[model samples]
Target: MSLAVAGEEHEESGGRLKAIIFGGLDGILTSFAIIAGAHGANLGPVPMLALGISNVLADALSMGAGEFLSSRSYNSYVLKEREREMWELKNHPEGEIAEMVQLFVARGMSRVDAEVVIERMAKYEEFFVDIMMKEELSLPVPSEEDTLESLKDGIAMFLAFALFGMLPLACYILAGMLAPSLDVTSLFSVACVATAISLFALGAFKARFHDKRYLYAGVETVLLGGACAAVSYFVGRAVSQFAGFEQLEFVIQYEQQPTVL
Candidate 1:
């Protein structure tokens, strides 16, 4: 591939990576909060695990669909802009040529030199097309391969959420299963600490893209996770209270449900 093609591919890769980071972090933090809150409110391990996994699935699917739509929207805008440029080049060749010459002059070329270059380039249709695309239009036509690659990127982003999001919730749930002796609150505390550290690390990594302070990103991520956990815990308590006697009976029935030998 030419340098231009290679550059465009690289940019698409960067965009996909960005999507993965944002979606993955969102899943991780959101699930962390829900699981932590459920645990804190003394919800049974089964219910807590079910809720966390369900949220992970729902959030991942939502993010993946959103990414696909956003990519399509961006591509549509670029295509429309390119079509507009093509029309301008077709209907007003002289005006487009003059615009190109002026652009070159603005970039430090002498007026006479810029005009001469434009004249020579206009003699070659391909050269003129390239100049208009690079300077006047500034819209690159993405190849078929690029479009497929972008879809792949969207899928990758979706999967990232699934993988990263399950980490904390899985840690807590599995810990409870493997060691029923340990209290859920204690298990949740461990999960929260682990989740906070992981999110802080991710936030720091994200700073490479946005040039934000590393400490601020780390603190923000950790705080967000904590806030989510707190809210979920209270919500679970409220739900349990509202459900009252029916909920207690349901919990008993759920617990008494026979396990297959």
Candidate 2:
């Protein structure tokens, strides 16, 4: 495989790109909110990192599983509709062909030409069913193994979420290890900068989906996502203040009292 998969396979694989971009976007925003909120809560590094890491894993799993189940449901619907089409072709050939003819004619195809076209198409049962599905039902006929394709999409979503979601947390881990003296506010600033850049780039990447200027898309993404994260931070701050949670400004040490259920 070429190292430039996105460039080389731009037209060939939209589904994978969609999973990667959207998943990455969701991951970044989600991680940013958790960190921002945790920071707002005045939690120590241990508690913040703990919250961020655990939430990332749990949410990533949910997103991945949700994507897989949705894809499976969609594939099941298409396959079931396909089987129904095949049955109609088998038992009600004339009616199905008539429907195809009407669709073609409604699109300004000459009646005689439409009849001739469908007549030839009807001779091939497989081709006939494919056309019927496309013209009559407006659904893509599944060509590959349905289960495998859905699984691939699901796995793509999972890996994307995990990889991208961990980015915000990675900043905290690296800073704690390398710059042990860095304060939480400064550390969070670094994370904010990194996340803003990532979100802008991802938004620009989305230019392929809609024919829009990359700058506009990038700004839109940053503004929208930043707004949401900001809300999370303020909410966390308000909740912490209202509840009078202890403020831990420690850099390394964390005190925890174990609870028994």
Query: lDDT winner among the candidates?
Result: 2
Q: Tens-digit lDDT track for model 2 on 92-204?
A: 99998899999999999999999999999999998889888888888978766867877887788888888888988897688778888899998998888888888898889
lDDT of 2 at 48: 82
TM-score quality measure for candidate 1: 0.71
lDDT (CA) for every model shown?
Answer: 0.78, 0.85
* TM-scores of all candidate predictions against the true structure: 0.71, 0.83
Residue 229 Cα positional deviation in candidate 1, in Å, after optimal superposition: 4.2
Candidate 1 clashes: the total is: 2
Task: State model 1's lDDT.
Answer: 0.78
**Candidate 2, lDDT over the whole model:** 0.85
- lDDT tens string, model 1, 22-121? 8778889778877766765677877877888998999898888887778777777776776776677788879988998999999999999999999888
